[model samples]
Target: MNAVLRVAALGLGQLVAIGLLLFVSAGTVDYWQAWLFLAVFAVTAWLPSIYLQITNPVVLQRRMKSGPVAEGRTVQKIVMLGLYGSLVAICVVGGLDHRFGWSAVPAALCVIGSALAGAGLVVTVLVAIQNTYASTTVRVEAGQHVVSTGLYGLVRHPMYTGNVLILVGLPLAVGSFWALAFVMPGIAVLATRIHDEEKLLGDELDGYREYTQKVRSRLIPYMW
Candidate 1:
């Protein structure tokens, strides 16, 4: 398929995935927060993908790639699936929490979380803009290099950082306090993935070791 078509298909697939996640979690199809989640994800994910498609189709296509790389990285993929499970858990738990009134998440808190989620989405777009080799997988691409500017100047893995915010914010935003508990597994998985990614980059990608020395933090600023 063409680049535009590919991006469209990806967007549609994500929307379906989000819907299914919420349905399985909540056991209903008319949930408001689920709709909100769909809208938020659509806006956050597609805007950047569209921009990348227009301004940098090659990079956009690279981000869309999905195939197995070399061996010895199966653990990361499994953990990544576990992370995705956590996300589905977040969706499901959020739905169940909403349905069963398990969480008294205030409307104000939900609004605030939504705002943070939106901001995190914007950061995701920035990550794509700054880092050309920002693939979903953990392997260094052919033309990958150190991106030490913008958010990368602050953290070595800004994409993952933004994702954490996205996943964390989604639960509260969707009125899922119990689901918030499930977020830790996803956080642990992502945190470990960052270490693995950095190790690979440090070993393979040029200037990454020096970049790590300068950045000194992986996810959090001045803490991690």
Candidate 2:
């Protein structure tokens, strides 16, 4: 299949799946917050893919080949599973929170969450534009080198930084404080994945070790 077509299919499928998960768990279509969250998510998620497809098809192609099955390392596979599971859990819990009125998140907070999520999406897109070798799966591809400019200069794993924001912001955007509880596990999994990825990059990719030293941060600046 063509990479563009594959990416489109995968993106559409994921969008539908998330919609179903949220609505089905919510047991009603009257959830305005869920609708708003989905709209924001769809735009942020798909627009970046389209941009990447136009500017860097290789990155999009690599991203399409993601999830646990695409991971070569056992630890990476486990991390991917945990990450995906947490994402699903967040959606489900958010929906359930709405169904049961678990928590009443303010409209202002929902707007803030949407903004944070959008910012994270932009950050991820910027990372992809700057680092052509930014594959979703953790592996040092052929001719792949450490990227230390732009966002990479700020942190060794800017992509993961974006991911953390998205994971944390999504639940709040959906108006589910209960769903926010799942974000921590996803972050822990991401941190573990980053650790393993750094080990691999340091061992296989040249100059990665020096890049880490120069950057001095993995996902956050002035901390960690």
What is the TM-score of each predicted model, taking all chains together? 0.90, 0.94
Name the runs in model 2 displaced over 4 angstroms. Answer: 1-6
Q: List the residue pairs that clash in candidate 1.
A: 25-92
Put down candidate 2 lDDT per residue, 1-224, tens digits, no spaces.
37666666767887789889999999998988778877776788876786678677877777667899999999999999999999899889989998999999998998888778877877887787788888788888788877889998888999899989889888988789999988999999999999889888889999988887799988889886
Runs with alpha carbons beyond 4 Å of true place in candidate 1: 66-72
Q: lDDT tens digits, residues 1-224, model 1?
A: 37777787788888898788777767877777667767877787876786688789877766666433422498677777777788778887787787788889877888777777777888877887787777767787676677899998999888788888888898887887888887788889888888777788889999988887899989989999
**Candidate 2 accuracy as lDDT:** 0.85
What is the C-alpha local distance difference test score of each model? 0.78, 0.85
